[model samples]
Target: MTGAVRLEPVDERNLEPLLSVAAAEAEPEDVMPPVDAPAGWSLARRDAFREFHRASFGGLAGPTRTAMYAVVSGGEVVGMVRMTRCDEPGVVETGMWLGRSARGRGLGAAALRELLHAAAAAGMHTVVADTTPDNAGALSVLRRCGAELREENGKIRARMCLDSAIPIR
Candidate 1:
């Protein structure tokens, strides 16, 4: 694929597109009960998901340890990615979604690689991601990015060591 997409830091003007992609990517099955949800999972709660991106991208309220970015293609936003809770010092968690229209084009993996690069650049030593077992697409992306998988708490968690200099490509 051509390198036509660019990942830019999230800002107020691009929050809506990010939210749209998130909502489109999310499925009823993807919704886990809030208590059992993974950390940084406010997006799984009732209606909290709608405005969750705003806290980080709209500058409303959220941990300063988080950084969000929008994946723009042909001048339009088609996906979103985030690296959060870096205050843990060497660790960070990633979350991302490609809009319905952008799926099946290898953009998901590309976006993930970009997010991992961002995390590594920020001095993170490890990056983690989790998805329901049914989400084969997501799991594939994680595996393609060289993440090690483990089954935990009914979810598939993937972790990658960013301290190494392995290129995501």
Candidate 2:
């Protein structure tokens, strides 16, 4: 695992690259089907899926509701971490993905730690994450970050409580 990756906030100019990395890392089985699919629907029907993420991450006030950070190594974006639906004022849910080249490096764990620290500084009480039962890597990262695990509805849910004294930097 390389020890030199850095995390930075996502800005409007970086959304396209972030999406491109996410798409490249996705597998056929990773695509979630629409809850209500029409019969004989084609791939184009998945436009809504892309739009969902686009609207979530793309906008002038991108940091208001959702916060994202890029993991950079050697001056290039190698992965990203995101915190969404942060309106709770005391909790946030986080999601992350690392590009193929960045896998096996400790960057995932580092990024998660940074996110938790940021959340704590923002006066958040809990930081939550979820992963499919099969994703060992993500589970490992969450565990390493002191997340308490729970199983429900076939998913592994994890959470960490923040210590209020830490400063956000």
Predicted model with the maximum TM-score: 1
- After TM-score superposition, the amount by which residue 6's alpha carbon in candidate 2 deviates from its true location, in angstroms, is 2.3
* Candidate 1 per-residue C-alpha lDDT over 1-169 given as tens digits, one digit per residue, 9 for 90 to 100: 5435678888768866665655556543342223444454245443465445556653212555667788887787887777787456678888777767777777777788787877777777899888889988898888878899999999999998986655555
The lDDT, on a scale of 0 to 1, for candidate 2 is 0.68
lDDT of 1 at 72: 85
The alpha-carbon deviation from the true structure for residue 85 of candidate 2, after best TM-score superposition, in angstroms, is 3.5
Q: Best lDDT goes to which candidate?
A: 1
In model 1, which runs have C-alpha deviations exceeding 4 angstroms? 2-4, 19-51, 58-64, 167-169
The sequence of per-residue lDDT tens digits that candidate 2 reaches over residues 1-169 is 3646677776656655655665566532243335454433234434444454555564223644666677777777777777765556687888887877677777778778887877766667888898988998898788777788999999999978786432221
Worst 10 residues of 2 by lDDT: 26-35
TM-score of each: 0.75, 0.71
What's the true lDDT of residue 102 in model 1? 77
What pairs collide in candidate 1? none
lDDT of 1 at 66: 66
After superposition, candidate 2 runs with Cα above 4 Å error: 1-3, 28-64, 86-88, 164-169
TM-score, model 1 to reference: 0.75
